[model samples]
Target: MTLQPTLPARVEKDRTTPPRSGPSRRRDSRYEALTGYLFVAPAVVLFLVMGLYTVGYGFTLSFAKWNGFAPNWEWVGLDNYKDLLWRDPVYAPRVRHAAANTIWVMVAAPVLTVVVSFPLAVLLNQVKRFQGVLRSVYFLPYVTSGVAVFFAWQYILQPDGAINSLLSGLGLGSLQQPQGWLGNPSTAMPTMIMITVWGHVPVAMLLYLTGLQGIDRSILEASELDGAGWWRTNMSVVWPLVRPITAIVLLLNLREALQGFQTFLVMTNGGPGDHTNVLGLEAYRLAFLKNLSPTLGLASALGWLLFAAALVLALINLRALRSKT
Candidate 1:
């Protein structure tokens, strides 16, 4: 009494639908390729004009003295490089001082970023309730406007500002700087380093968190079951596994510390009498802000020197990371 409908063993092809011919396929592919190129054309053109062209021009300009506006560029050969590298008495000493300061920052910032951020990231990864809120809070600094935050920090580090007031309230009044933190040459550099670390920690922590999340939960559990403590599990197991992330964070922070001048420009303007002056600010100062006598060639030479140092350090880091891996 029951009728069961049986399905067809083979479904018939649609004879009315023609397969795409070779020429049509090729034409479609060509159209797709053209569309993709058109999509990227603006970015490619911009890079050619603003990035490569500017770099080439800067490289060429390094050998010529120009006020950045003059029609005639005086070809100075290697004089600009020589002066910055220790030929001119005035420029050489400043350059050396800036180089030293730059090196200090370049080494310290990335190290501190790792030291602070990794611990914070580990702790954050363990967080459960309100985790999203906490992460957003941590990430705020990275997303916040740099100039505004730097200005706020400048205010906070001032003599009568919140930091000094807090110190006084805590009965650490002796530690309070009457001349303001940034006003004192002794404290200026360290304070800036601290700010840099604080600003950088968020991004580094986020990277570490991402790396930590990618780790297998079973691996962590196995480590725990094998009588490994939290510290040992993280140090010996987790940290090693997160080496790639750590390398990325370190390289990024290193590059930033090497090339950054915005914070110094905003907060101290390379002052407390050049105590916080770095090669980045020095280059900027030479190119644009040296009492209307902008040494465009000298600035370009300094910029190239900075570029060389960055390239060498990057290569060294990559090599070391590869060796470890």
Candidate 2:
């Protein structure tokens, strides 16, 4: 038998394969980098122009006095900050009141929303029928126009409105007769809190539902095999796994509650006695609603204040909710 010479593997592979030289690899890497830059260019430009520039301009404006239609701004150093923090009597009370209201809503709304929505999400997750319809129904308000929803709630909360009428029909006439929810100073903030909770619950529910769906089925099965009840399994197995989602939901809810303006704007207009005024609405009132001269500087200061508060709270939330593992 004649022995055939063994062919080299490199030669055999080279017949069917193209070699990737150093220059080719470098060129490919350059091409990928270019494509990435092209993809992100618009977003970067937008952030610079609409986000960074706007924020920087606003911060600068916080240091200068401008009446919104002025040809020139009078640079006042930290005078704007001083007035807001300690000096101006007329504006100082409003700032404190608005800050208090904002903090109340920020604390209450997120807690209530999570408490109410998490169960709804779990229930919806277990449902084998019409889950889409139920989810859409719950999520409708989130997608609806803010102005429209606020107005709708305004009507609903009026003294002779649907809620009061229902209370009266159910023999809770004493509760109905004393206060016009949106019109009363005492009840207005709580009513706003309720409306906020209602509007925001759906979003939390959706997020929780998504988190629930992403949980490992094997872990759930193992928990069940260990004879864990629904509440027990969720507490021990599910909660820790979905802590990140909870953190996200908490942070988002806190941010939205802190920055909310429209609901108060339409429902109460910070009214009855600045009872429902929040930081965002107070900022707007300072900027545009003052008849004598717009306090654009003060408004800008309030905006920055709100930003700072949100940032601090976000950090706190992150630290609090961070998973130990």
Candidate 3:
């Protein structure tokens, strides 16, 4: 038996060993490249890490009753969420008010921007001298800080802010009077919306300008040859071409409006009352302002709900764009 086994030891070993080839080696290299690409995917990697930390932590915190810095906390299940939804009177309406304000901002910012900016862009485009300078000057507010910004605007809107100052010069009503530009409920939302629009119009103008530059001169010439007036050309030619840019500008404005905490925090702090409250400001109050005990659960739930709404809106926009295309 030993002799029979020893007859072809090399052959037996060769039969037992696995085989390797050029194609196999090449396949192995490709496999490695695939994994390497995944490792280096900046966006995917960043999303995973950031999402895991933010979304996961937020979700976890929602179920626990944690104070600002205290390590001692208890599992509260859906209690916080229930409290925000129905049980707690203060937080419930605050969320509703905040949502309404956010919607106003979202609608007002971009629409007002389009109304104010399109003409400005056209005017600026036509100008030969200091055009770029004017555009830059207008765009300054987009890059400005919210902290000092609100104060300036507050003064202007103040019983004696800029608007008041001009009004007083013109012998109009005083801004410093108890008219409640910010303090009163009726004007608060509108005031915030105007602020939102004023701050964002520059961005809309810039994007519209960029899109306008991309319009073919030949197309405009052709439209003019077809007896199209300025309005006709805009509706039939320029507007259609600039649709994508408009959508993008609107999307940006919507995001900003939905995240409308800065305006609330700086100027109104969600109001002299809850007049300017939006979900964003309410979330802030629940999470940070109210107590050492955070309403993380409700905040997270509200955040997810808002995110879902935004996603739906975005999808709707995308689908509409696709249909147009």
Candidate 1 overall Cα lDDT vs. reference? 0.93
Ranking by lDDT: 1, 2, 3
- How well is each residue in 150-249 modelled by candidate 3, as lDDT tens digits? 8888877766456656666887764434654776677878888888888888889998888888888999999999999988988789888988888888
What TM-scores do the predictions have? 0.90, 0.86, 0.81
What CA RMSD would candidate 3 show?
10.7
How far does residue 121 in candidate 1 sit from its true spot (Å)?
0.8
Question: Model 1: how far is 66 from its true place, Å?
Answer: 0.6
Tens digit per residue, CA lDDT, model 2, 1-325: 9999998777444465677999999999999999999999999999999999998999999998888887999999888878887799988877888888988988898889888888888899999999999999999988999998888887788877898999989998888835578888888889889988888888889989999998889999999999999999988988778777777787888898888798888888899888888989999888889865858999999888889989999888777866453
Question: lDDT of all predictions, in order shown?
Answer: 0.93, 0.87, 0.78
Q: Rank the candidates by TM-score, best first.
A: 1, 2, 3
RMSD in angstroms between candidate 2 and the native structure over all alpha carbons = 4.1
- Residue pairs of candidate 2 with colliding backbone atoms: none
List the RMSD of every prediction in angstroms. Answer: 3.7, 4.1, 10.7
